[model samples]
Target chain A: MKTRIDQCLERLRKTRRKAFIAYITAGDPGMAETVDSVVQLAGAGADIVELGVPFSDPLADGRVNQDAATRALAAGATWGRLLKCIEQIRRKSPIPLILYSYLNPLISRGFEKTARQATAAGADGFLIVDLPAEEMEPYSRILGRVGLNNICLVTPTSPSARIRKIAGLASGFVYCVSREGVTGMQKQLASSALGLIRRTRRWTRLPIALGFGISTPEQARAAAREADVVVVGSAIVNRFAAAPKTAAGRKAAAQWTARLVRAVKEV
Target chain B: MPRKRIDTEPDAHGHFGPYGGMFVPETLMAPLQDLEREFRAARRDPSFRRDVEYYLREYVGRPTPLYFAERMTRELGGPRIYLKREDLCHTGAHKINNCIGQCLLARRMGKKRVIAETGAGQHGVATATCAALFGMQCVVYMGKVDMERQALNVFRMRSLGAEVVPVTAGQQTLKEAISEAMRDWVTNVRTTHYVLGTAYGAHPYPVMVRTFQSVIGREARRQILKQEGRLPSALVACVGGGSNAIGLFYPFLQDRGVEMIGVEAGGLGIRSGKHAARFADGRVGVLQGTRTWVLQDSEGQIRLTHSVSAGLDYAAVGPEHALLRDLKRADYSHVTDREAVDAFYTLARWEGILGALESVHAVAWLMKNARRWGKKDLILVNLSGRGDKDVQQVSAWSAKHGGPKA
Candidate 1:
C-alpha cells in the first residue's frame, strides 16, 4: 500500500503545484488543541501535517520551536500522550501525518516498536532531526517493514556525493535545510536554496521540501518556485506561542498557516 | 557474549560494548570522520607526540608533584593519602592537558578556529589559553548561569582573547552549553574543531581525550614507584564526565592489586532527585553523541541535574566509565554536597590546599572510607583544580549554610 505521504506528493505532482507542509509541536498549547491544530492546518490547505515531539534538548532548533517544546513539555506531553494525540487527529483528518522528533525519544521506545506503534497511530513517516544518514539504514529498514517512510535531510553544507547517498536511501522525500543555521523564521529565504535544490535534482527523482527560516508569504512563494514542498514551522508555531492559552491565539495560528499555504499554492 | 578485555576498545565504528556511537546530525558526520582519521594518524607520529610533551612540560607545567598529605592522612587515621597536584597546572585544572592536545591536532588539521563548551569555566579557560598560545581564533560556549557563578574564569577566558558566548537554553547549564557548542560545530565544521571538554561524546573523542589525559596516570604510576617503591593500594578521583578519573585510572587498569574508585556528585542526596550521580540514578541512553548512562525521565527527556560544583553538574558520564562499571574494573560512588564542602575546608586547613569543589568529592569519599582500610594502605586522589575560581560562590553558600568562613 502506498503511504499517505506518497499519495499526497503524487497528487501534488499531477497538479503541478508545490505541496504546503505545516509544522506544530503536538502539545504546545495543550494536547486537545494540538489535535485541533492539525485538522485546522489540513483545512487551511496543508498537504502534509508535521507534529513535533517535544524534546528537552533540541540542538537543531532555534528559539521559536525550542519555546514550543518547552511549553509542550510543561503541559505534560509524554510519548504515549503524543501517540494518542496523533490517533485523535487521524480520526478527524486524512492529511499525511509525519512524526518530527529528535533521536532519543524514538530510541528509548526501541526503533522497531516506535515504527509499529507510530504506524498504528496513523503516522505516515518520521523525520528525526539528529539521526544522520550514516546511522539511518537500520531504522529505515525497520520503518519500511511497516510501510512507513523514513524521510531524510540534506543540508546546504552536504557534499554532492553525500547528497546522492542520502537521496538513494530516502523513501518519502528529501528535506532540504535552506540555510546553515538551526530551524527559525527569517525575513528572507537563503539564496543558496535554489542551487541546493537544483543539485539535489541531479541525484534523486523523489520530491524535495525546503524548510528552515521560510517565514513570510513572499518567502514562501519564493521557496515554492524551486521545490516540490514548502514547510512553514516557526511562523505558525510562533503565533500559538504568542498567546498560548486562548482561542485568539489558535485563530491567529490558523489564519497565518492559511496565508502561507495560499502563497505556496499561488505559485 | 563474554566481556572483552580492556585493551580492545571502541571497534572501528566507536562502540564501547553497547555504548559510544556517533549520534550527531548529518552535517557533523564528515567532520567527525575527518577528525577520527587525523587522530589515528597523529597518534603514531613522533613529532606530534613530541610537541604535546613539550607543551605539557614547559607551557602547562606537567609532572606536577605527587605530594603525600601527611596531616590529612594522620587525621583520617587509616590510609596514607597522596594528592596528584593537577591544581598546579597553568590554568589551575587538568582540563588544560586535553585542550593542548586538541589544539595541536586542530593546528595539524589546518583548522584556523577552535570552539568548546565549559561548565565551571576551567575547560573554557584551558581552551582559550591553548588557542591564544597557538594563535588560533577561539570561541567558548558557557551557560549563562555558569558564567554568573564563575565570573572570574569568564574574565580570564575573555582576557585570553576568546569570545565567550553565554547559552541561555535548557536550564542554562553544562548540558545546554554542550548542545549549543555542537550546533556551532555543525555550522562551521570545515574551518573549526570542537575541542570537547571531557572524555565523552562520539568515537575518537572519548579515545583521543583518554589518550591525552593518560599522562596523569603515567606520571602517577612512575611517581608512586619512585617514592614508595610500589604502587598505591587504591586510586580515587571525581567523575565529572570522567576525564580526570579516566586519566588516572587507565594506566592502573591492568594491576589487579590496585583498586580504583570514581566519585560522583550527590547534590543534596540521591533520593532528593537533585544530584549528578549518573550511575546511581541514570539509565542507559544517548546524550551529546555517545550512548552512555544518562539521567532521563521515563519518556526519555533529559532530566534536570543539580550539583554545588558547576563542573560536576551534568546528566551523563563518559562511555568508558560505563564500560568499567559493567566490567567491575572500577567501583563508582557519590558524595553529598555537604560532605564535599566539609572536605573542601578540611583540605584547606590540613594541607593549605583549597581544592575545587568537584575534586573535593573524591577527597570526601577518601575521608569517609579511609578508616575501613588498613593503616598501612596508601590512597591517591586527583586534585583536579584549584578553588580560587569557586571561592566567591562557596563563600556565599557558606554564609547561608554556615559552612567555612572566608
Candidate 2:
C-alpha cells in the first residue's frame, strides 16, 4: 500500500513537475495556528509539508532551526499534542505530511505507540535526523506496521556503495542532503550537491529530495533542476520564528513562506 | 554473567551488548567510518605507536607513580589503599593522555584542525595543549555556564592558542558543548577531527578514547604488580563518561578476582532527583549519539544533572560501562555533593593531595566502604586530576554547602 508520501512523490514524478517540500516547526508562533499555517502553505503550492516535532536537543539543526524548535516547545509542543495537530491538519488539508524529529522523543514515548498514534493522526511519514539506518530496524518494524515510511537521508559525504544500500532501504523517496552540515540558510548551494544527486540517481527510481543549507529561492530552483523535490527547512522556519503570535501574523508568515514554495513549483 | 572479554566486547560495530552504536546523522557516517579505519590502521602502524609513546613520555609525561596512601589507610585502620596518581600528568589530569593520542591521530589522518567539547574545562585545556604542541588548529566548545565556573581552565585553554567557543544550547554544559562541536564537525568534516573528551559517543570513539586512556590502567597494572607484588583487590575511579575509570579498569578486567567499581556523582542525593547517577536514576535511552543509560525526564528529554564537581555533572555513562554494570562485572555507586567535598578536604589534609572534586568521588567511596575490609584488602583509586583549577570552586562550594569538614 502506498503511503501519502509515496503517492505525492509518484504523482509529482508522473506530472513531470518538481515538488516543493516546505518545512516548519509544528507549532512555532502558536499551537492553535499550526493547522492554519500548514493549510496556508498547502494553498500556496507546497507539494509536501514537513513538520518538525520540536526536540530539546536538536543537534542536527543550525541556530535558526534550533531556536524555532525551542519556541515551538515553549508554546507547548509534545509528541502526543503534535500528533493531535497533525490530525487537525488532516481535517483541513490533503497536503502530504512528514514529521521531522530526533530519536529521543520517539524512543521516550515508545516507538510502537508513537507510530500508531501518528498513523491515526494522519501523519504521512517521518525523517528522524539522528537515527541512522543502522539503528532503524526496531523503529522501522513498528513504523511498517502502521504503513509509514521512515525517510532515508543521503549526504554528500556518503560513499557510493552505502548510497546504494541506503537507497535500497528507502521507501517513499530518498532525501539527498545538499551539503555537509546541520539545517540552515546558506548564501549558495554547495558545489558537491549536484554530484550527490547524480550518485543517488543511479541506485533508485524513487524521487530524490534535496535538503540542508537550502534557504534561498534561487538555491531551491537550482536544486529543482536535477532533484525531484527541494526541501526548504530553516529558511521557512526563520520566517515564522519572529512572526507575531496572532493568527493573522502567522498567516502572513505562512504566505511569505508560500512565495518561496510557489517559486520552486514553477520549476 | 558472562566472563570479561575486554577488547573483544565492542564487536565490529562498536556495540557493547546493545549499549553502543553509531546513532548519528548520515553525514557523519562516512567520517566516522574513515576515523574507524584510520584508527584501526594506526593501531597496527609502528610509527603511530612510536609517536604516541614519545608524546606520552616527553610531551604528556607517563608512568605516573602509584603511591600508597599510608595515612588514609591508617585512618581507615583496616584496608590498604593505593592512589594511581593521574593528577600529576601534564595539564593536571589523565585527560591529556587521550588528547595527545587523538591529536596525533588527527595529524596522521591529514586533518589540520581539531575540535573538542569540554565540561569542567579539563578536557578543553588538554586538547588545547596538544593542539599547540602539534601545531594544529584547535577549537574547544565549552558550555557558557561552565566557562563562568571553570574560568581558570578557560584562560589556560585560550592562552594555549585554542578558540574556546561558549555553547548556550539547552543546559549549556558538557553535553550541549558536544552537540555544538558535532555541528562544527558536520560542517567541516573534511578538515576537522572531533577529539571527543571521554569514552562515549558513536562507534570508534568509545573504542578510540578507551584505547588512548588505557595507559592509566596499563601503567597502574605494572606499578601495582611491582610495588604490591599482586593486583589490588579492586580498581576504582570516577565515571563521568567512564574514560578514567575504564582506563584504570580495562587492563585488569582479565584478572578474575580483581573487582571494578565506578563512582558516579550523587549530587545532593539520589532521592533528591538532582544527581548525575545514570544507573540509579536513568533508563535505557539514546542521547547525543550512543545508546546507553541516560538521565532523562519522563518525556525523554535529557535532564539537567547537578553535581558539586563540574566535570562529573554529565547525564550519561560510557556504553562499555553500561555493559559491565549489567554483567555485574563492575559495581556502580554514588557519593553525595557534601560527601565528595568533604573527601576533597579529607585527602588534602591527610595525604597533602588536593584532588579534583571528580576524583574524590572514588576516594569518598573508598573512605565510606573500605573500612569493612581487612588490612591486606587492597583498593586502588584513580585520582584522575589535580585540584588546582577547582580551588576556587571548592571555596565557594564550602560557603554554600557549609564548611568542607570530615
Candidate 3:
C-alpha cells in the first residue's frame, strides 16, 4: 500500500527539485509547540517532517539530539502522547510525518498494538534507529499490515550485501546516513557517504534521503545534490531550543527554519 | 522432540530461545556479523588457542587455587565451603580472561584499536592491560558516576595508557557507558574491536564471552573432583552482567544434580524502588544490543538503577542468564548493601579474604543462609575479584553506616 509518504516521494520525483525533510523531537518544549512547529515547518517548505520519539537512551543520537530528547522526555513525552501530538498535527498539516525512535519505545509496549495506535493516530511510519535488518522481518510484516511505511536506513559502514538486503525490504524511502557516528552537526561529511549512496542506488528505486550531521544550508545544498531528499535534524532542533517559549520565540524559530529550507530547495 | 541442550543456544541468529539477537544500527550489523564469523574461525584456529593458553597460564596466572575455607566453613557450622580464587588473577579479577581472549582476536582481525565499556572499572583496567600487552590503542567509556565510585580502577586504566571517555548521559553509569561505547564502535568499526565485557549484548558476544569466562568453572570443576573425590553439591557466584557467575555455572550446567545460584545486589531492598534486581519483576526489553530482562518503566524507557557495588548497578541481565532463569536451571537471590558490607568484613576476619563488593554479594548471600546448610553439603563459591580497589569506598561506607560489630 502506498502511504502518503510514498505519494509525497512520487510527487517530488516528478518535480526535478530535491525534497527537504525537517526533523524535530515530538514533545520538545511542549506538545503544543511540536504540533505548531510541524505546521509551521511544513508551510515553510519541508517535503516531510520527522518527529523523534524521545527515548531515555538514544544510542544513535549525538549530544544535541540526546539533550533534546531528554528535554522532551522530561516534558512528559511517551509513545501514546507522541501519537496524539501527531493526531494534532494532522489536523492542521498534511505533511507526511514519520516517527524517529529507538526499538525500546515501540517494542517496550507491545509492537503490534503500539504500531496500530501510531498509524491510527495518522502517522505515516516510524524509523527505529537501532533495529538491524536481521531483526526487522517480523516488524516489517507488522508495519505492512497497518498500511504504514517502514523507513530503512543505510549507513556509510554498511557492506554491499547488507545495503542490498536493507534496500530490498524498505518502503517509502531509504535513509542514507551521511557518515559514521551519531547524529549531530559535523564540519565535513565523510567521502564514504557518496560511495554508500551510489552503492545503495543500484538496489532500490525508492527515494534516498541523506542525513546525519547536516546542519548548515551549504552542507544541506551539497547533500541535496547527491540524494533525492536532504534531512537536517539536530541543527534544526537546536534552533527552537535556544529561543524562549513565547509566541514570538516560536515564530522566530519558524523564520530561521524557513531560511534553511529555502536554501536546500534552491539546490 | 528432544529437550534442547543449554549449550546450543541463540541458534544461528544468536537467539537464546527468544532472547539474545543483534539489535543494533545498520552501521554495526556488518561489523557484528564479521565478529561472529571471525570468532567462529578463531575457536578452531590452533594458533589462536595457543596464544590464549600461553597468556592465561603465564601472563594472567591461571589454575588459581580452589581453597578449602576451613574457618569460614567452621563459622557457618553447616556447609563445608570452597573458594575458587579468581581474585588471584594478575589484574585481581576474572575479567582478564575474556580481555586476553578478545584482544588476541582483535589482533587476529587486524584491528589495531579496541574500545570497551566499564562499570566499577574492572573491565576497563583489564582491557587497558591487554591493549598495552598487545600494542593496540585502547579507549574505554565509563559513566561519570562510576569513575568516582571506582576511582582506583580508573587510575589503573589510565596508567596502562588507555583513554577513559566519561559518559554523562542518562543516569551516568554502566548503561550510559555501554551506549557511548556502542556509538564509538559504530563510528570507528572499521578499525576498532568493541570488547563487550560481559556475557550480554548481541548474539556472538553472549556466546563468545561465556566461552572465554568458562575457564573459571573448568578449573573449579577439575580441582574440586580431585580434592574431594566428587563434584560439589552446589555452585554460587555474583550476578551483574553474569560473567563470573556464568563462567562458574556453564561448566557445571550438564551436571544435573549440582545446584546453581546467582546473587544480585538488593541495594536498599527491592521494595524501595531503588535497586538493580531485574529478576524481582523484570521486563523483557532491548538495551545495548541484546534482548534480555531489563529494569524499565511500562513505556519501555530504561530506568536508573542503583547498587552499592558499581558493577552490579546495571539495567539489564545477560541474555544467557535470562534464558537460564526462564528455564529454572538456576535460582537468583539478592542481598542488601548493608549485608554485603557486613559480609565483606566477616569473610576478611574469618578467612582473610576480601572479595570485591561485586563478588562479595555471593558471600553476603552465603552468610545470610549459613544456617540452612549442613556439614554434609558442599558449596563452591566463585570469589571473582580482590577487594583492594574497594578499600576507600568500604572505609567511607563503614564510617557513615557505622563499623561492623564483632
User: Pick by DockQ: which candidate is best?
Assistant: 2
Model 1 chain A, poorest ten-residue lDDT window? A243-252
**What does candidate 1's lDDT look like per residue over A1-267, in tens digits?**
689999999989998989999999989878998988888778778999989999999888888898899989999998899889989988999899999999888888687888899999999999988877766788888888998888888887888988999998888899898977788888778887999999999999999999999889999999999999999899888876775466656766787789999999999
Tens digits of per-residue lDDT, candidate 1, B222-254, equal: 999999888889999999899999999999988
- Per-residue lDDT of B224 in model 2: 89
**Top lDDT prediction, candidate number:** 1
Task: Give lDDT: candidate 1, residue B191.
Answer: 89
- Candidates in order, interface RMSD in Å: 1.5, 0.9, 1.0
Q: Write the per-residue lDDT of candidate 2 for residues B1-406, one digit (tens) a residue.
A: 8964654368677899979998899999989999999999999999999999998998777889899999999998977899999999999999999999899999998999999999989999999999999899999999999999999999999999999999997888888999999999999999999999899999989989999999999999999899889888888899999999999988888887899999999999999999999999999989878999999887787788998888999999999999988877899999998889899999999999999999999999999898667889888999999999988989988887787533
TM-scores for all candidates? 0.95, 0.98, 0.98
lDDT of 3 by residue, A1-267 (tens): 789889998987888778888999888988988998888888778889999998899888888889999998899988777878888988898899898988988987689998899888999988988888888999999999998899999998788888899998889989999888889999886677778789999999989989998888788888877888889999889988998887677677877887778877887
Q: Could you give candidate 3's per-residue lDDT for residues B282-316 as a string of tens digits?
A: 78999888899899999888888889899899989
lDDT of each: 0.91, 0.89, 0.89
Q: Supply every candidate's count of residue pairs whose N, Cα or C atoms clash at under 3 angstroms.
A: 0, 0, 2
Docking class of 3: high
Q: What is the lDDT of residue A126 in candidate 2?
A: 83
Better of 1 and 2 by lDDT: 1
- Tell the DockQ for candidate 1: 0.62
